[model samples]
Structure formats: structure tokens, C-alpha cells
Target: MEVKHERVKQCLEAMMDSGQLSVGERLPSEILMAKEFGVSRETFRAAVKMLEQEGRLLVKHGVGTFVIQPLPMIPSSLERLSSIGAMIRTAQLDQGESRIKFTKEGCSPEAASALGIKLGDPVVNMERVHTANGEPVAFSMNTIPQEIAGDAFDHDEFQGKLLQFFEKRLGRKIVTADSEICVPLHIDRHCQRLLLHPQTTVLMLKQVHYDEANRPVLFSRDYLRNDVFTFNIRRTT
Candidate 1:
């Protein structure tokens, strides 16, 4: 009986990871879930109770069980450079997506300074929302030199790491980055809508990537959903 209950728990967890069961979505009734899993009602109840104790599900007395919003903590090493996609994959999250909201040719003073370009130099700007397991986790704005990012850059083709696109087009790898993290009081309307937690504080990451020759290649500003992602750093002497 214990073994059967454990299997039920594992199956449900996998469903959540694969986005088949989304956050805040209600689960089927105990009888249906038990039948679907080919388990007895007692075993199914044991599994559900375990998940509830783990804070993965919320059960109401008369209502059904629902998946709890997960707080996925992503550990970031200060000594290394990593992309949001890489972090999501490292956490073994299923179905990561970066949906491009828009792309334009523009130049911002801050982007110019970070990329070490003239004030009016053209830059390709892109805005995207990063999702893990079908839940919005971060919103990002990326800027790249226009010469490196040609006019053929397609927003729809962007899925994983943005740096991979640059590396493929420019034939130069990003060697390092200067990044800073801060807690911001508010985010834009787009991010608020996508994240579905408008009033929550956000963690902002400002980063500038450099190529092998130490030339700044990309500048990015990322707003992270604080409730969903917890960033941590490790220190050693």
C-alpha cells in the first residue's frame, strides 16, 4: 500500500513539472484520480495528503484539491554567468518557453553606455517573457548592436538562450558579464499582467555581456517574479 501511494505521488509530481497540471489549477476528484492512477482510494488519499503536507497542494473541506503555486528557488553562482533558460533546465523544469512580445530598432542611453557605443547608434531591442512549466517567471529586455544583430533576426525563432543567437550569428562567444541584482518596488504593466502578481516586489537583473576580446556585446534588464523565484549566492574563501 505504501509503495502504491508513493507511485501516485511521483506521477502527480511529474505532471506538475510537465505543465500538465498548472499552478492554481484544481485537481480531479479523489475517486477519479484514484481510478486514473489505478490505485485504491486509500492509496490515493495517502498520496494527496503527502503532497498537501509538502505544500504542493491545497485542499478545502468541501471543495477539490488544487495545485499550489510553487516557489522555485534558483541558485545563482556569483562567479559564473548563466541564462534564465539554463537555470530553468538546471532545475529540471519541464517546458520552458520565452515568448517574444516585441522587437524594435532603437538606442537607449543606458544601453549605449553598457555596450560602449555612440549615443545614437542603432541597437536591436527585444522584450520577452520567460515561463517555466507554463507559469511566467521573468520578463526580459535585451539590447544588441545592430551590426551584429542583422535585420534577419526573427523573434519567433527565439526560444532558449539569447546569447546562443548572438554566438551563432556573430561567430563570437560571450566570455563574461557584469551583472547586478536589485529589488525593485514595481514592474511595468506588461510584466504585471504576465506574472499575475502585480503588487509583488520584483528582482531586477542588469547585465552587460562581453565577448572574448572584452567588447560589450549585449545589454539586458530582467525583472524576475520574486514569489516564484528565489536567487541565492554562495560564498567561499
Candidate 2:
């Protein structure tokens, strides 16, 4: 026999997936929902709590339960070299960064290859979580050659965009960037760190940025929530 709470949860999930319940729409009262699901109020409440914990629903103390909105979508063109910060702003959404970690470390093989530097060379690494409307939407790890970062490189003064920081702070203009898109095979580890649902779709972009002289100046790995980002590529005959 199916557990009462489990059955109720599945029905609620189906309703939301089918668009029967829209974001910010309140669910029926507990008594009504319970009766409709053919379960007791306790069982229905348990189901609601499960969805709330999974970030699918919001429960208010004095108010009612409402479907939680997913992260806002940001549309971008592959033709433009746009930063994550710029994307959020273009969408007219509030941008924020958290879990920032900046340090000098030995370059990894991947970073060394991307930046065209010898392995084990010193590099400046910056890791951060990007957020929109107080919701985490992406995680990024960026590496810069020690020669380019220089002694004047100060992480504290970094605003949001790395491209802007390079241009304004270091006088390094990025003329071009190459990006490769990939899907993560395992996103559970990232989900736990970003407070995302385990089933959230994620896309990863590995990039190498070059200056006007064609020298690679930066390498980065960006993991973004598919719910929040859309990239368009124009096709011409």
C-alpha cells in the first residue's frame, strides 16, 4: 500500500509540474486539501512540509502555503562577451555575491593549460557564488596568471564582474573569450553548496579569455542554474 503522505506529495508535485498551480498561487486550505487527497490533515501537512523543504513551496506562519518561484531567467547571446553580473543587471534583477574566497595558489594542470602557463606556476584564484534577488544562481572559479594579477591585485576591491575588474583595476582589456558548454554528470555536491534542489538542471562553461595581443589572461569554470540562464546562438547560412 502507498504511504498516505507519499501519495499526497506525488499528487502535489504532479499539479505543480502540470502548471495547474502557478508560482505564488496558494494551495487549498489544509482541511480541504486533505479531504481532496483522501488523507487526514496530519498526512497532508507532512506532504506540504516535504515540498517546502525541497524549495518547491513556501509556508507562512499566519498566511497560507504558496508555490515558490524559481530563479529569474537571464537571456544572453553567444555573440557577446557578457559577464554574469551584466546578465543579471540586464534582466533588471538585483545582483549579489557571496561565499567569496580569494587566494594565491599553484596553478592546476587545467588552469595552466588554459592560460598557457607552465604547470605549478603561481596564480590568483577567486571563487564566489552569484545570486539574483537573493537567490543563488551560479558558482564560479576564476584563475589569473600571477604576472597579470600583479602585487596590486586586491580581492577586497573587486566589484562583481571579473571582466570589469581586469579592465578597470589592472588595465587589461579582454579582446576575446572562448567558451565550451557542458552538463555536469553529478550536481548533488554543487546543489548542497548552492542551496539548490537536487534535481535542478545545471550547465557548466569552461572559458579562456585573451587580450588584444592574443595572450590568455584568464581561465574560469562557471556552473550556472539552467532555470536562471538561457544562451542563444545565431545561425547564418
Candidate 3:
């Protein structure tokens, strides 16, 4: 049942992507669309409901459904695990030039607690900036135990994708993360990196990523420009 609804939802998204359905245009009747997709009305409706919750469709009680213009920001799903670079690519936005700097340092008290490492343990400190359409949208700092990241890790090959580097290069699978989200009253340090005004709103996500064996492998803090990024989560009772 879930698979059928997801398939229909993907078809609807493809229609919008191909320009067959334009913003402000009403979708076809549920019965008609269900027939076209060879699915039951319940399944089609479920898919439509999913899209509506995702802010893609406007559904009226008695009137027809209308396509909504997607918000002009990168959308990140809290329920899914993804790298910053992956999020930008999934949004179908043209990526601008980005930069990364790597430094070797002893673990901070905070990093040590999060990564379950002793203070003063060797770690790799990575600072990265992510840009979209020529504007900086996010700044991030990640700390990894030197043993996990390996002394011979190649910065040129990393390119700021920690998840990919862990799985592909290091042969370690990152399966989950524990994240805390917050809004800061002041983020002068992050603002300078994102090239935003001092007063601009920002969302910060502090996370500890765990490997398949439930061992913490990465500790990161990501500062996202509120104007350029939207984070969403789906909750069920």
C-alpha cells in the first residue's frame, strides 16, 4: 500500500518537473487521475495528501486541487540522513563554487563528549562552506576522530561530503544521527562565513553521526541561512 502511494506521488512530481502541470493549475479529478495511474482512488488520494503535506499542492474541501509554486529555498527532511552537498543536489539547484579547509587538532571538550573520545585526542577538523546560485547558504564544521578518519585521508577526494567519504572511501556505513536543532540570537562567527548580515536569522543543527555498529563517528554543527533553507519533518500519531 505504501509503495503504491509513493509511486503515484513520484509520477505527480515528474509531471510537475516536465511542465505538464504548472503552478496555479488545478489537478485532474481524483477518479480520473487514479484511473490514469491504474491505482485505486484511495491510493491516489493518499499520494496527493503526501504532496499536499509537502507544500506542493493546495487541496480544497469542495473545490479542485491547485499546484503551488515551491518555495525558493533548499528543503531538508529531518527524517532522512543526507549530506549538505546531497541536499543541494536533491533540490535541483545549480551549485555554486564552494570551499573546504581541513585542520588537525585535539578534540574540544564538546567534541570529545559527543564523539565519546577523551579530551586532547587527535581529530580532523573540517570547515566547509556551501553555496547555491552563487550565494553562500550554509557553513559547517565537522570533527572526526583521527583513527576513524585515518591519517592518510585525502582532502582533495573528500570535496566536503562526509557521508560519502565515510561509506565509499573508508568502507564505513553511517546509518543514523542524533540531531539537535536551534535558532540562535547571535551567530556572528557563522554569519561571516555565510556572508550574511549580522541580524539575519539562522538555524543550527548539531549532530552526532553513528556508524552501522552504533559507534559515533562524526560530530558536526551546521549553520544554515534561514532565507535559503527550509527544514521539514513529518509526524504521525
Candidate 4:
């Protein structure tokens, strides 16, 4: 039923992520694709439509369905909160390297506001680029109170899963996070270089992670390459 169609959708997404289906390439005929996936034509059509809505596929009236060049979308299901590293692993894609660009021990006004700290309070700021399959995908800046980060925060040894690292260090769990997504009109030169797409639109995510006690701990701003990632949200009444 619905489960079968969901599986079909996942398979199609995997195919795209693995480069089995390149951008601008035509998908097999509906009948053939349905047969290959062992799903009914109706179910297959439903999956295709889902992908189209996600900007992963383009449907033509008479020609055929074509793969869109945008980067593989990592589903951001509203039903549950998950880390970007977890999402990448779930997609069966390499979590890749996290390049630590810089680390500073001071708070900006914006960081202070987000973390609920007073101005001039000590904070640790980290700028990093997350890659996938040797290609850059996200440029992120994370700010944490200096007391939380401590002196043990070594950029070289720190890799993926910042939440996990913070939780382990503070001996507390990140119970929840509030996030907002937006399209930015402009991206700075540094972010543009990291994304490797000078002219592409940037998708920005602003998030604040809360501890078990509902204390704001981490503030992050992530700039995602428009063509390298897509986010999906499922709304329910």
C-alpha cells in the first residue's frame, strides 16, 4: 500500500544519489519503471509526483520524466528531528569531511542573543564546511558558550555530530531544537567559495539547540548549496 510506494520513492532517491540516474537523463517509461520496481503504475506515478514536488524530477506531458540536476535532497521530516550527519548516513552517502576553517573565543552580538548570553561573554565560534563525496555541501558557523565548550574543544579532532560532542562534553542531552529555513538573496564570498557555486542561490537555516533543562546551548547558521541539498517538510493537521 502506502509503504510500498514509500519504498519506491526511496529507491528512486537512492538511484539519483548514487548517480545511476544523471541529471537531464530521461527515466524509463512508466510501465517499464513500475515493472522494474515491482510497483503498480499508479503507485509509481505517485512516487514520481512526490519527487517532482521536491525538485528532484521534472515531468513532461508527452516527452518523458527527466532527472533534475539539483543535489540529492535529504528529507527533513517534520515528524522527527535528526542531525544532518544522521540524515547523510541514512541516505547511504558519505558523511564526508568537516573542514574546520577557524575557531574564535569571543561572542558576536547575534551569537549572544541567540545563546541568551550577555554581551562580551566568552563564547567559542567555529566555522566549518561539510562535504559529501569530496564535494562541499554546507558552510556552517556554530557558536557555543565558552564554559560549555571548555578548553578541550580541538577543531582538528572534532568531526561530525556537533550535538553529540556537546552532549557528551556537558553531560546533558539536546532534547529539542528550533529551526527556520529561508532563501537568502546574497551569499558572501567565503561561503560561495566553500559551496563551489558562485551564482547559486543559498538556502539558510538558523537553529538553536536546547538542553534537557530547556536551556539554549548552541546557535548555528548553516548555508546550504541550493543544488547540493533539498529539504522536505510534511505538514499535518
Tell me how far the alpha carbon of residue 137 in candidate 3 is from the true structure, in angstroms, after superposition.
0.7
Angstrom error of the Cα, residue 202, model 1: value is 1.5
Candidate with more favorable, higher TM-score: 1 or 2: 2
CA lDDT, candidate 1, residue 230? 61
Using lDDT as the yardstick, the better of models 1 and 2 is: 2
Q: Once model 4 is optimally superposed onto the true structure by TM-score, how far is the C-alpha of residue 162 displaced, in angstroms? A: 1.2
Give me the candidate number with maximum TM-score. 3
Q: In candidate 2, what are the lDDT values of residues 190-227, reduced to their tens digit?
A: 54455467566888889999988888999988888777
Clash pairs (backbone) in predicted model 1: none
Candidate 4 C-alpha lDDT tens digits along 42-117: 9999999999978899999899999998654336563356766665665566978777864656688887988899
Model 3 agreement with the true structure over 1-237: per-residue lDDT tens digits:
559999999999999988999999999899999999999999999999999988899999799999998765435778888877777776677777677888998999999999999999999988888888887888888899999888545546675467877888777799999999977556468755664665557888999999999999999999887766678885557
lDDT on C-alpha atoms for all candidate structures? 0.79, 0.84, 0.85, 0.78
Candidate 1, 1-237: lDDT as tens digits: 559999999999999989999999999989999999998999999999999977799999798899997555436655568888776665667646667764565688899999989887887788887788888777888898888777646546555567777687667699899989876654466446444655556778899999999988889988876666566775436
Deviation of model 4 at 125, angstroms: 0.8
Model 3 alpha-carbon miss at residue 141, Å:
0.3
Give me candidate 1's TM-score against the actual structure. 0.61
For model 1, the local distance difference test gives 0.79
Cα error, residue 187 of model 1, in Å, equals 5.0
Show pairs that collide, candidate 4.
71-227
- CA RMSD, predictions in order: 15.2, 19.5, 7.1, 11.2
